[model samples]
Target chain A: MVIRPIVSGFPPNMHKVPVFADHLMLAQRFEHPFSQELGLTGFGLVTCLEGEAQFMINDQRLLLNTSSFAVINRGSRLMINVDETPARPVLLFFRSILADVVAAEIFHRQSGHDKELSYAELKDYRLTEYVHYTHASVKEVLEQAIQLSQSCASFQALKTDALLRSLLQSLGQENYQAIAVSARLPVVKQSTRVDLYKRLSHTKSWMDEHLTEDISLEDYADMALMNPAHFLRNFKTAFGITPHQYMMERRLELAKKLLQNTRQPVQEISEQIGFDVLSSFSYQFKKQEGLSPSQFRKQVTTD
Target chain B: MEESQWSKFKLRVNLNASVEEAYRCWATPAGLEEWFLRDASFKDAAGNAKDKNTLLQEGDTYQWLWYGYPDSVMEKGTVLKANGKDEFVFTFSLGCPVTISIYKEAGETIVQLVESDLPTDQGTMLQHFVGDSKGWIFYLANLKSILEGGLDLRNKKEELVDVITA
Candidate 1:
């Protein structure tokens, strides 16, 4: 696994600030399945810039695609995986110290009082569950943060603090409080759910890597350590699409890439992407994309 | 127009260090991080560094990250020349060529930097020339301070105002 760290900095001990930020790009293919266990010491804000990624936070499966954002509370156990597709993410880490500073500032502005607030008091308003949002405003702020991070201009730290404050304001405290309350009720069944999701997500990643190979429902179910019937139902429920449909969609996406990039004949391209018959490949291509494979190539080439 | 027709800005500072030491500060990643950038790494296309704790060579590329910035923000450039203990040239922001020369004068190291090949357009020339001139002046003073007084004057904190303004 080749992970390129674009920018990373951690505040020194005894510093006024308690924040660590990392921007990483995972562009290389992993020869072996790669996973990392992260025990976050601070609140984590992860923004996906491109491609797809899957992360398990406190045993809850979270999918991140382009412009997706996830906020993880401090002390959460997170398992992160880079999808076969290249994934780039910007991660901002801030400790409870910084959180307290922001909270105090907010409180002072509202009440005109400079009172000290504990982390426990902040907890009531903090996001406990790993929250995910696909909002445009979040993406815009993250983009600005990325730009400011690259600039050599002075006052970047001031700008970064403002951006962080803006992010917290945008994600209203009431919404997090509601999510935190609801997340507590599912603890009893969470272990099994975590196990099931982990296996299913692993199998799904396997399917993505082996898109050019023929795979069956039984193969994926076995990988998930479940019977085909149970696996089929759970997979559909977990991903909102049946395994067969998911595989077909992946194949069609690959077919589109091949059609656009390569000069191979339709029959060869179909076989290369695990389609045994040209007619079935062309039919699926037309069904998914309004144009046939050849038409897509011609249209894309002309454009 | 000939390359000589390009506008050039030069700045020189006298440091209480040897010529070799001043050159080392400019040529090595460790020296750069002390007073210039926050992080610096030099690597080849194969993602290998010849010596993890040494000076960069001609043709080597570098990625530089500044303090108090997001990890995703970095500067990348290739070393155009590295004359032993005397002169170094590299591409700065926006492909502008920068040359740093070190000389022993008056029992001190005089480090002179020249940034050339700026845009010839009247507006661009004024903006870049003026902006870079101010920036270099501040940074050179910072380099002198770190070398002489052993104090870093960078605004490493997020709340501090910028020293350089538009």
Candidate 2:
């Protein structure tokens, strides 16, 4: 495959650098009529500038509006087109090396694990997929990049590139999932609902932090500063489940993860998940997972 | 991250336009209305228009009444500093409190925004509020497109959703 860069002025060494590209670029919206094949070596980000664009990645058609951005997975086959206008989009390409180093440092992957480069995997890559910037902040980053790219000196552009890469990595999946949940809701101010939501949110965090404890409905109400009856009614309203049920469900989920990841026995797993009795733990695990503890472990290992 | 604490984020942009032009785009009722929204008005806490030096003065609070919303949002905070040509600092309130500083960097202006003293609920919510965060991410992209490319996405709200999801 002939190696070509859509933009000019990058160093020849940049072509061979093995990390995600840390630089800002600007491009008008334009179509690449010829399909491009990117191999597992690197990935790219295209932010539409003037017009609409379409990125066909691994058979999934992702449309890029003026502000819409899409991450092109490494080695993925893509057909990129600016259909609304002939102007091409500004593209930022990051080689896998940056992610590799980050994963090694933050996620602590074993030294020699091969990083998966498929589109499906990249979709779950929280760092690169979404950077939750305020509407104004996003403007600021793009505008800064544009200025730096157009600068007579390379210093600003280099710095801007570094900042951009860091920004991409900072956008974790946790943020993306939360934002996805918020955008789907109707815009209405329900004070009662909001208050209930506040309590539920508090309870969720409290539960996560106290997963090892013998938590009860009364304890949850105390955390939220509400009466037990009030807590139960509002918790149901906010989460569609009573506090006790929610806590149990979360505990079982944790138990399942522990069982799958750890070599601990069922009794230990049950104890770890706040269940005092091994039989009770076994029963609850079976009820939630549709399998006994040993059977679940066996299925996980074999699969 | 308690309700009493606040988080801050900043973005700087280099505009092809001049400082006054950019300032006008953000400051004036007419200018802010054009780029920010179709109907824009500035009011005080008691609901009155803010004008002139009062509009740009330190310690002065301006409430921006946006279209579709009955209540206006407030902007409070002293001007930490201002360069008539390209820089200024001000405090603003969204649903939460934030201090914003705007400055010009070379050809572009940088807006350093610090949203602090957020209630624990807001902070924790903001920390994990994925849906709100993503919306802001996309909205910021839209802001850049409008400012630089003269593209307005609000008009294409439905089509935007369609093509994006399609």
lDDT per residue, candidate 1, A249-272, as tens digits? 989988888888889899999999
Candidate with maximal DockQ: 1
TM-score of each: 0.40, 0.30
The runs of at least 3 residues in candidate 2 whose Cα sits more than 4 Å from the true structure, single-residue gaps closed, are: A1-26, A29-41, A108-139, A172-303, B1-166
The best candidate in terms of lDDT:
1
lDDT of 2 by residue, A1-303 (tens): 012344444344544422432332435434444233332324556555566666665554666655456554455555555545565555565435554444344443223445423333323442233211122344445655554344332122223434454545543233233233332234365434333444455465557667779877788889777898877876675456777788788888888788789999888888888887999989888898899999999999899
Per-residue CA lDDT of candidate 1, range B69-103, in tens? 54444556788999877999998744688899999
Error of 2 at A146 (Å): 3.2
Q: Residue A87 CA error for candidate 1 (Å)?
A: 32
Q: What does candidate 2's lDDT look like per residue over B21-117, in tens digits? A: 6665555556545544444444554555676333343333443432222121112233333344444454433234434345567657554444444
